[model samples]
Target chain A: MRIARFDDDRMGVVASDDTVVDITDLLEQYDPLDAADLLPDLITHFDELKSELESRSASGGGKSLDDVDLHSPLARPTKIICMIGNYREGTDRPQQIMDIFFKSPEGISGDGDTVILPPHEASIFHHEAEIALVIGKESKDLSRDDAMDAIFGYTVFNDVSARGLGREGINSFLGKSFDTFAGFGPWISTPDEIGELYDQHITVHVDGELRQDYNTSDIERPIDELLAYISSITTLNPGDVICCGTNHQGLGAMQDGDVVVTSVSGIGSFTLNVRDSDARQWQRGVDEEMAARVRAQGQEAPAQGNGG
Target chain B: MRLVLTADDRIGVQTDNGFVDTSSVFDDIRFRTAKDRMPRVLAVFHERRSQLEELAQSGTAEPMPALQAPVPRPPKLIAAFGNYREGMDGDRQKQDLFLESPESVIGPGGTVVLPAHEATIFHHEAELALIVGKRAKDLPADESALDVLAGYSCGIDVSGRGMGRIGPSRIGKSFDTFTPLGPAIVTTDEIADPQKLQVTLTVNGEPRQNYSTDDMEYSVVEILSYVTGFMTLVPGDVLICGTNHQGLGAMQDGDQISMSIEGIGDLQVSVSDPHNRDWQRGIDEEMAARVRNRAGSR
Candidate 1:
């Protein structure tokens, strides 16, 4: 029951045999960018559509998965909320209230896409791998007991961050919202198939070297609690993603020409290439100003010890 | 030419005579076919600026109806934090920026419902809002940041001091109806100098905030240039150039707040208690249930 949007906005079902059964007809009325608006319809009619996809696959007119480009499973999410400092085991800092931040929808890049590093010389880009929850229905003030029901599926999210900018007071949103900073999904795995959401293992690798490996069980606030808190603040619409925070124990930076892979077991994985921005010369002054401000603020400079 | 979106989602253009339905005046086949797909208010303005301008001069005038947020549900709403020199938490050094929930936007004449949790010590921040016209990303040195703007409008950045003092400003500034925008979007061509406009806010007929945009630490171009340096800003995205700290104070329920920019028209809003509002009662009940359930489980 893996649903995906691939090459040229065609909707398809990934069969167990690693082939894609075209189900574009079922979603003819909606455009590729309107995938979020079509999510509830897909969920409500999942059974009928699943059977039809199976029949279509049986007729032997499917394509191999390798033949097409895979896009993000959920397109045009109204919001992408990321939990900050939700992991407690790795840090000795005092436990504070759970902080949530936002990343622009434009930052989202699909599987096999490239994440362009900010041209600023001041930026020290880092990768945070965590599990992401895709909303199935419009939700508000959801209770812990009902929070899990509101989730349609799970995907892996790479919360790419500019550590230098982020540490400079109240720039968390900007630091994590650069173009192509958010990389999620090969495809979405439904909640039922994920068995126990909190028990799954999450991992991140940079150029084949493991950078972070941890179990979701290590999360301080469970998935239900996070959902309840976020829902209480604002409405969560279909296709919206909630990225659970990552453990900072093995957190590090990414360099140009590096490939970062983030994976959640029993779900899926995706890789994104890192490239330097073309406007590096235009960014020099701003970067220098930011660095000078960081020095003026008199805060401890961000540790540059974790070079990849 | 000024454009507005009414309560019914109809588009209108304000001219010297009155407001006219844009569809009635601009009946081109291409425009009719592409209107819904554009997804952003700025897209329509960008594609058919000349046609719209010609129509604005000759279109039949009609009386205005209740207005909605000009660009309701913009893809992104980025606000400048402490960009003004007179503000209390002013960091005269560099511009601090933060993202606000687009859902917080409410049209002119809408009520700013004080969240039940922190009902006391609310503040009103009147500011100028820039509507981006094109897809701008990593703007080159030669391009002027102002060139990317489609128009300008007025917005109130309501803050709940209780919640805002705790940590990041997102939660405090993001309550529903916290952002009151509109009246009409004055085209960038209409304004002579956006940097020197007068910004003022009055609460219940008493003048509280009055300052010129000249007091801002960073000019509009500088702010937009810095923002585009990080993320892409598409048409219909909004940037609220921060508010002046002068005359900053608390607002209370039943206060009628009005924010006006020199060129753009005024945006009037009423503040109400959310605890007693019909829609908020449901949310409050759900929140109470969660609190009780959590306590019981513990």
Candidate 2:
């Protein structure tokens, strides 16, 4: 099944060309929270939603894909671990392979969303078009085959970066992790129908001319080997998104209004615009926590007082 | 006032009382991702840095309740000292201490629960907090200057005051609640001059110390510039500019702390019992179980 977060950032799955239906309604029909997990339970509930979508599609009572805004496929992942430089042509050193790094979940942006480009950022920002997977079950020390089985599906990711961010070398995590720096989506593809992850063709473009064009098979260490290497170092939680880095063709500076597209074979493409900057303006996430802690602290909250 | 937070397994928001309703707040920055409700929440302080603080002083402002504080353990927290002449009262010269290698840091509402060991006394140091909002390396531009500041909140450096002449005790400072923050973030727009704001700290209702941001050895901009030379700062990161001096003394269980910065707001927290199994009982039980298992196997 092709899974997506669409229709005003609500849950849905896309079928054929014209039909995009909210799985959340189907989720309400069965259990309130099951459809949100996006794995086992979400995959398991597909039969019910499919039958409903089929009926709804026949009646044309649901939303078409064009009607709503699309968000990055996952709501909030456990973690986002991107390899620093995994491309064959990135560098010539083996020890340099799999330089693991993290980006906060807040950086994710979706199709057609504007990705701000700050003039202060010096390094080239690249559109990394690579086959990436979403973990299904919690995994540790996964065997090569086990790692393959653990992949629930695949998606397109920009691995949006500041090329010069890491050159100074004291701390690259900051450079790679700016607010709204990452772009992914259209949808998540299930592993069953997708072919071997190592053979997909990835293409990158600026204004329609091909820039980065490479095959997954060209990856030096391969997916299974890379998984084995990564699993040895960190635990793999479900919903963790790891892009297998970008080929050198994905490099260069991107200015405002540049619509960069990254597409992986069999999955889909993700297009994002470069905005100037998106500074943080948050009240923090404290609704449920606020109520609970207030009662414990002997203070009463307003009826609608969970979130501030 | 309520400040929300989301983390690995939980989300929490602090209010006038304490931490409340943390379940749904995904540990994500609100304004950057939560746009639909930005203007409704106090996130205005984030987008319009200087004008709002000025407006508030001019008495032409909307009524927003006081927000708590917000310091979700940033990806990184780089701290600094110096500026306040009081900074020189410590054993080290204020000149040498201004650049004290980061000894320790704790997040808002996160604990700094002291172990019962005879380590030097652990105490709270409240300072004007600086949160970096963008990727700032060898950076410039003052107009873009305040752009890098994510938001400001009051935070304590929870230091083990007596651990002198030796490396600071990571354990002493790392206690769970030592670094508490998150009533909610005070955006730069809310405070026109973060330097002139007043800061005060109290324990169990007795005022322990007080000072102003104006006494600092270095300005917020200068300090951020100096630190950026050696480090690449990113969004959701923080720096606890050194705190005002207070005489060091022993801390006991159930000590209540109240701290605040003028317009940013105030926070109060208390010491509590640890949530782990009893130390000696846990060790004895494990040893006993191992011996019985060995006998049965034989």
Fraction of native Cα contacts reproduced by each candidate = 0.24, 0.00
Q: In candidate 1, what are the lDDT values of residues B30-78, reduced to their tens digit?
A: 3211222223547656778877777777777888888888876667888
Which residues of candidate 1, in runs, are more than 4 Å off?
A30-61, A90-95, A277-308, B24-41, B87-92, B140-143, B162-167, B276-298
What lDDT is reached at residue B296 by model 1?
16
Clash totals for all candidate models: 1, 53
Candidate with the greatest DockQ versus the true structure: 1
| Candidate 1 local lDDT, residue B219 | 81
Q: What is the lDDT of residue B80 in candidate 1?
A: 85
Compared with the true structure, what per-residue lDDT tens digits does model 2 show for residues A25-113? 55554443322344334544554555664565444434677786777787655456666456555334333323455554554678888
Best by lDDT: 1
Question: Tens digit of lDDT per residue, candidate 2, span B142-249?
Answer: 445667776678877665432211122222343334566645566676678877989887777776657888877666776676555434565556677775453222
Docking class of 2: incorrect
